[model samples]
Target: MNTIEQQLWEYIDGDLDEFSKKAIEEKIKSDARIKVQYEELLKLNSAFSALDLDEPSMSFTRNVMESIALAPAPVAMKTKVDKKIIYAIGGFFIVSLLFLFGYSIYSSNLSMPKLDFNFNFNLDRYITPTVLYSFLFFDLVIGLVFLDQFLRKRINKEH
Candidate 1:
């Protein structure tokens, strides 16, 4: 709105200081345009004051809540993840570890070592098939636990 209308509104609302109020009153008396506008605003303000404010029915809030309750619960984004992808990744790591273990065993020298120590340490007696298998199983279990923890941390960071 123009400055004249704004000043007139402030004047009508009794929001202006004495100096500004007196200045606006002088303008309203002298300017025919300002005088007409001021009258119109006064009628509009009176009409607004005459209006009765509307309130919603008491059941309005309850009806809205009930409708919201009828809708399905939202599912978490993490819960939507495909199990097959996780299983495939886990399987790949397991197969890779198994291949690496097999390669290391195949390339190692199983022959007896010449030792100068008084206590004879025989490698063959300790490095049996059962022991190797147990070691590999233990490493696989530890790897799976670490992978699980890593995946959980990564998932939490993403969300």
Candidate 2:
């Protein structure tokens, strides 16, 4: 009377313990409906288990190895960059940096147009020649530090 499909599958698969196995066996013997269902499930299980697996060709591995050996080793996918293109890009960046440097120096020297707002304070008074020069030196040091780091990284990358 206790007819769970899963228990029947477990029974068919030989997974149930002795007590459960005996209980199902008694149920099947006493109930004609349970017996028919159990037989049908066993038949389906047997049909699935009896299927023949397709075997591979005898020289499958040899054919694979031969094909691999015959073909050229796969070339790494890398762009074939021309030296001229790299130089052109470098030249462009250098020219831009030079242009910016010249513009900054030129603009700093050019006469400033008169401002409508009257200011009594002068920035140059606070930033004396010594302070200005010291700031310039610090800026130069920072630039050199960055340049050194960049050059070291570039050298390591090339290696």
| CA RMSD, predictions in order | 10.4, 14.3
- Residue 83, candidate 1: Cα error in Å is 2.6
Q: Report the C-alpha lDDT of model 1 over 85-145, residue by residue, as the tens digit.
A: 6886688688779867765765564555465334334456666889879877977886798
Top-lDDT structure, candidate number: 1
The TM-scores, one per candidate, come to: 0.51, 0.43
Model 1 CA deviation exceeding 4 Å by range = 55-80, 99-111, 114-159
lDDT of 2 by residue, 1-159 (tens): 454678888899999999999999998899998889999999999999999989989999999999999999889988564576567558656865875675465446444457544323345556567975785686677568656766886797689
User: By summed lDDT, which 10 consecutive residues of candidate 1 come out lowest?
Assistant: 113-122
Candidate that would win on TM-score: 1
User: Candidate 2: what lDDT?
Assistant: 0.76
The TM-score of candidate 2 is: 0.43
Steric clashes per prediction: 0, 0
**What Cα-based lDDT does every candidate model obtain?**
0.84, 0.76
Look at candidate 2 and tell me the lDDT of residue 142. Answer: 58
